[model samples]
Target: MRGVVLHAPGDVRVEERDDPVIVAPTDAVIRLSATCVCGSDLWPYRGVEEVDGPSPMGHEYVGVVAEVGGEVRDVRPGQFVVGSFFASDNTCELCRAGYQSSCVHRVPIGGIGAQAEYLRVPLADGTLVATPGTPPDDLVPSLLAASDVLGTGWFAAVAAEVGPGKTVAVVGDGAVGLLGVLAARQLGAARIIAMSRHESRQALALEYGATDIVTERGDEGVARVKDLTDGLGAHSVIEAVGTQESMMQAIRSTRPGGHVGYVGVTHDVALPGMDLFFSHVHLHGGPAPVRRFLPELVDLICDRRIDPGKVFDLTLPLDRAPEGYEAMDERRAIKTLLTV
Candidate 1:
């Protein structure tokens, strides 16, 4: 099989790799139908996240089950499924409490590398959710989105407490942020403010239900959000770009008692305790427990109630993953879909 490996910063290659085999009673091997480059992947590609050596890349995937261990019963060979970046035993206490990302035995799919012809997923029953049927060809991209970004965006909205009559602000306009706008709308946020200087992203934000667009960033962006909310700030803020500036913008855009849900992978961000304390804003963020929302999101996509797939502005053959990564890293594409 062929898979992606990052040799160093700016070096991503698809090369021959060993095939995956089930290694645990809860494992399942699936032939990837689709996978994509994630914003988080850029951290290492840009050297923000150190790479000790050649590292397997990519996490988001949607595929058809090829094999399942004896213990795996619900998911079977030939079923199309989607799984989150974090593989968890949904039966665990934390998972039962809707925090599958923190499950007792959580495994990161990124480390395993889904940008390949095949993948071995642990906690098969808990981590993989089967679609209603083999999804139509047109729905594949959307289903693939549900495997990660869509689910993460939904988690961001939920964590931000977006709800009826509330004003919501989203920082960042990446795939996750764009979907955050969609998620906020679905959760009934009365007004959504998407911050992005890119016209393409700003247009998509509006298409995804953003009522207002703020191109300003940092403190000025925060002020614009406040101005939209009549000087009270938004009731909920979703921070999808994990950066010091984006984080501070999110915190500052919310009202004193408001909630800020950050789903971006934090890199060099260090929050000032005193400033956050004085702000009186509720801050909550981490790896999105995407497993918890997979079922509902799958339903929404299958039913054509939402179109998160639109986030993927470019698609490439699995062998062309380098172009996909470059497109995203250069901000020439919103999201890149890799067809395996």
Candidate 2:
């Protein structure tokens, strides 16, 4: 099989690799039908995250189950499934509480590399959500999106408490943030503000249901949001870019006693205890418990109620993953879908 491997900064390659097989009785090996490059993948490609060796890449995937371990009864072979980036037993105490990403047996799937012909999913019964049927080619992208970005964005919206009569602000124009805008809209946010400098992204955000767009950055960005909200700030803010500046912008853009749901992978961000206390904003985020929302998101996509797949502006063959990574890194593509 061939898959993506990251050797160093700006160094990504498609090369031959050993095929995956079920090594655990709780695992399932699936042949990937569609996979994509994630904003988080850029962390290692750009050297923001340490890479000690040529490591496997990719996590978001939708595929047909080729085989399932003896212990995996719910997800059978031949079922089309969408799964989270983090595999979980789905039966753990944490999973029962809706934090599958922090399950006692949680496993990060990136190391397994979904950008390949096949992937071995641990906790198969819990991590993988089977679609209604083999989704049509048209619905594949949307289902794939549910595997990660859509689910993560939905979790962000829920954490932020986006609902009817509330003004919501999304800080980040990436795929996840755009989807967060969509999530906010579906959750009935009365007003959705998207903070983006790129015209293309701004357009997509509008199409995704954003009522306003703010191009300013840092303090100026917060001021614009506050101005729009009559100096009280948004009722809820979703921070999709994990940076000190973006985090602060999100914090400042939320009204006192409002919620801030941050899903961006934190790199060098550290919040001041005093500032948080004074801000009086509720902050909740971490690796999104995508598994908790997969069932509902899958239903929404299958029903054609939402079209999250629009986030993938570029599609490439799995073998051309290098180009996919480059396009996203250069901001030439909002998101890339790699077909196998």
Candidate 3:
């Protein structure tokens, strides 16, 4: 099979790789229909995250089940499925408590690298969720988003405790943040303020239900949120950019007792303990337990209730995976969908 590997920063390639096969009784191998470059992928591409050697890339995916191991009774060969970056036994104590990403038997699917023709998912029965049926071509991207970004954004909204009559302020304009706006709307946020500098992203944020857009960033951005909320900050804030400035901005943009759902893979952010002690705000986030919401998100896509696929503004063949990474790194595209 052909797959993507990163030789170094600013370097990505498509190369021949060994095909995946079931190695565990609870594992399943799926032939990918589509995959994509995530914003997080930029971390290593730009060298913020170390690439020790030729590292395989990608995790978001939607595909057909090519084969299943003996213990995988929840899905069968020939069924279409979507999964999370982390594979977890959905029956575990943490999973039952809605924290599958932290399940006791969790496995990182990123290690398998879905940016290829085939991927081996362990603990398959609990990790993979099938769509109502094979989704049409038009719905493929949306379903693919559910595999990661959409689910991550949805988890952020839930963590923030967004509710009816509350205001949501999202920091960041990447796919996750933009979809955070959408999730906020779906979760009943009465007013959503999307902080973005990109015109294209701002437009999509409005389309996704942002009631307001703040082009300012940093301290000015927080002040803008306060200005829009009568000196008080938003009722909920979603921090989708993992940076020192973005994290502080999110923390300062919410009212006392408000919630901040941060889902961006934090790079090197450190919060001031004294500030946090006095902020009187709630903070909750981490690697999203996408498996917890895959079923609902898949149903939403299959039912045509949401269209998160719009986040993928660029599409390329598997061989052009390098170009996909370049476009996203340069911000020429929000996300790139790779055709298998």
Candidate 4:
């Protein structure tokens, strides 16, 4: 088997590695049909996140089950499946409440890496969801999107309590943020505002159902969202970029009684208690319980109700993951899909 390894910042290499195998009764080994580089992958690659040593890369994946452990009964060999970045025991109390990302036995699959031909998925029965049947080739990329970006965006919308007739705003124009617009539309929001300075991302956001686009960011961005909402601010705002400015912009762009669903992986962020205490707004979000929405997302993709795969503007073979990373980091591609 071959997989990419990150020896240091800006350094990625694809080379032969030992094949992954089932090591737990609840584990499953799947031969990846497709995988991709995530926005989060750039953190370590850019040295924003510490790279202790050579690290395995990738987490989003869609594939066919090659093997399954004895305890994995929900999936079987030959079945095509999509899985979340974190493996969770769906039976846990947290999972039952639709927070599988924090399941009692949750495991981060990033440790094993999915940018390879094979991947060992823990908590297989809970983490992996099979499509209605083997998906057609065209639906593969959309299905892969459901495994992460789509699911995360959906979770953000839910957390923000978006509903028909409500005005919504998205703070970032990245893949997750663009999907947030799609999720808002699916949830019946009356108006969706996408904050993006990039014309390409702005176009995608519009196609995804955004009614307006705010080219400014930070304080200016918040004011723009408010201006469109008649100075009342949007009813719901999705914070997809985990940055201090983005977070504050999201909070400031929401109505007093509105909600802000933040799904960005936080990095050295702190909220001013005085401001939040008087904002009179609802706040919720973290690692999205993608597993919580996978089943429905998979169905939507298979039915062709959404085209999230368009996020993957750049596609390359798995071995060229380094180039894919560079493309995304350099803003040359919104997202990169790696073919196995």
lDDT of each: 0.94, 0.95, 0.94, 0.94
Tell me the spans in candidate 3 whose CA falls farther than 4 Å from its real position: none
Instruction: Provide the global lDDT of candidate 2 against the true structure.
Output: 0.95
Task: Estimate TM-scores for all models.
Answer: 0.99, 0.99, 0.99, 0.99
Off by over 4 Å in 2: none
Task: Assess candidate 2 and give its TM-score to the true structure.
Answer: 0.99
For 133-233, candidate 3 gives per-residue lDDT tens digits of 78899999999999999999999999999999999999999999999999999999999999999999999999999999999998899999999999999
State the local distance difference test value for candidate 4. Answer: 0.94
Instruction: Compose the digit string of candidate 4's lDDT tens values, residues 1-340.
Output: 9998898999999988889988999999999999999999999999999999888888999999999999888999999999999999999899999999999999998889999999999999989999888989999999999989999999999999999999999988889999999999999999999999999999999999999988998788888888899998999999999998888889999999999999998897899998888877999999999998998899889999999999999999998999999999999999999999
Report, for all candidates in order, the number of backbone clashes: 0, 0, 0, 0
Point out the worst 10-residue segment of candidate 3 by lDDT. Answer: 294-303
lDDT of 4 at 101: 92
Window of ten residues with lowest summed lDDT in model 2: 106-115
Over the stretch 131-238, how does candidate 1's per-residue lDDT look in tens digits?
988999899999999988999999999999999999999999999999999999999999999999999999999999999999999889988998998898999999
Q: Number of clashing pairs, model 2?
A: 0
- The superposed Cα distance between candidate 1 and the true structure at residue 137, in angstroms, equals 0.9
